[model samples]
Target: MIDGDDVGKRFAVVEHPMQPRALAAPMHRHHREDEYSFVLEGRIGAMLGDTVVIGNPGNLIFKPREQWHTFWNAGDTPARVLEIISPAGFEHYFRELGAELSNGPPDPQRLAALCARYALDMDMSSVPGLIQRFGVRFPGGPSPAPQ
Candidate 1:
């Protein structure tokens, strides 16, 4: 992860593995930040606004702030993507989530509190359908955002 503190608040980058048939995140939107995903290997499926498309390595997909979006591995093989979130700082959300998870399964209240502190809006309502329709894996539990 690229710490925002070291980047003049420009952006933060995170590299994530997208296991075969795995969804990176549930449908959600950041009202204060924009995110772009650059595929590093294999293939990925993404929903940006109303368009849903499959992206291959080297493809860069944008999910602007205030837009609901999600991405998943769209192939039989593992994939990877580099996520860049602009204006920095949201990386702290992912960091705290890891810390909170070290104890055990996530507590709904703590997860909610974390989301509130990060000003993130995440919805798991469409997760089941997404997993079914896209044949993607959902990180079992009430966790709304990606790891």
Candidate 2:
């Protein structure tokens, strides 16, 4: 179980299998923070601006401040990753948002609202394809109903 829920600047290393989903961090461009991630297994897709990059084991991605980006696991097997935020004190946003959404999957409108609040404008018309490709499931929702 990933106690990523446990808070503090120094994170205790823990890994858990997450059902696939295009998890987006509320859209905030870091001006002084640089985000880095390493793929331990499976495919990880990252969207930055209009560019989408797929990451596999041995792949490393860097998103400099002022560039908008988010990532999601995009494979049958669960993807594992370790993310680092530079200039420090940057994980708080993630911690708080995780707490809010930890209760359950937000309704579509809520999800979109949160995304809009964060500036993550996502098009769910293609979400079905992503679900098919990534094998992602919402936290408490049944397997997506056929579209």
Candidate 3:
């Protein structure tokens, strides 16, 4: 989580690692905040609304609030993405997830509740097809339950 959220501000940045051939997060959308992702390394493939876009290092992409989106690493190497969320606090969701899973395995019920609190709607139905399309692996395991 970024310091901006700690100060109660309008933006927060999170550095997300997109492991080689892995999904970053379930295809989802947030109704409360806009998000921007700046690619730092490797390749990233994203579904923004109805379109699919792939970005290389130094590429930047926007995910407007309330628009359905999802991303994954599409290359043989690992990837890095700097996610900037506007109108902060949502970053806490990511932080808490790390803490939660560290204690044990993932708890979908807890995650769903937390996402509801942050106005995040998740979708995972596209994972299989995407993995086949990109010829990558879904080492992230089971996708999150839909919101």
TM-score winner among the candidates? 1
lDDT, residue 55, model 2: 86
Ranking by TM-score: 1, 3, 2
TM-score of 1: 0.89
User: Model 2 misses residue 3 by how many Å?
Assistant: 13
lDDT per residue for candidate 3 within 1-147, as digits (tens), equals: 575747677799999897777777667899999999999999998889889999999999999998998888877788999999898878888878788778775788998888889899987576676666656555446442332
The better-scoring model by lDDT among 1 and 2 is 1
TM-score of each: 0.89, 0.59, 0.86
Those runs of model 1 whose alpha carbons end farther than 4 Å from true positions after fitting are 141-147
Model 2: how large is the Cα RMSD against the reference? 5.8
Report lDDT per candidate: 0.84, 0.58, 0.81
Q: Compared to the true structure, candidate 2 yields what TM-score? A: 0.59
Question: Which residue runs of candidate 2 sit more than 4 Å off their true CA positions?
Answer: 1-17, 26-28, 105-147
What is the Å distance of residue 116 in model 3 from its true position?
0.6
lDDT (tens digit, per residue) of candidate 2 on 1-147: 223345443333323234455343333455656777777877887777668798889898777777866667666567787776654545544554576678776567766565555443445454454445444544443364343
- For model 2, state the Cα shift of residue 46 in Å: 0.7
Which ten-residue region of model 1 has the weakest summed lDDT? 138-147
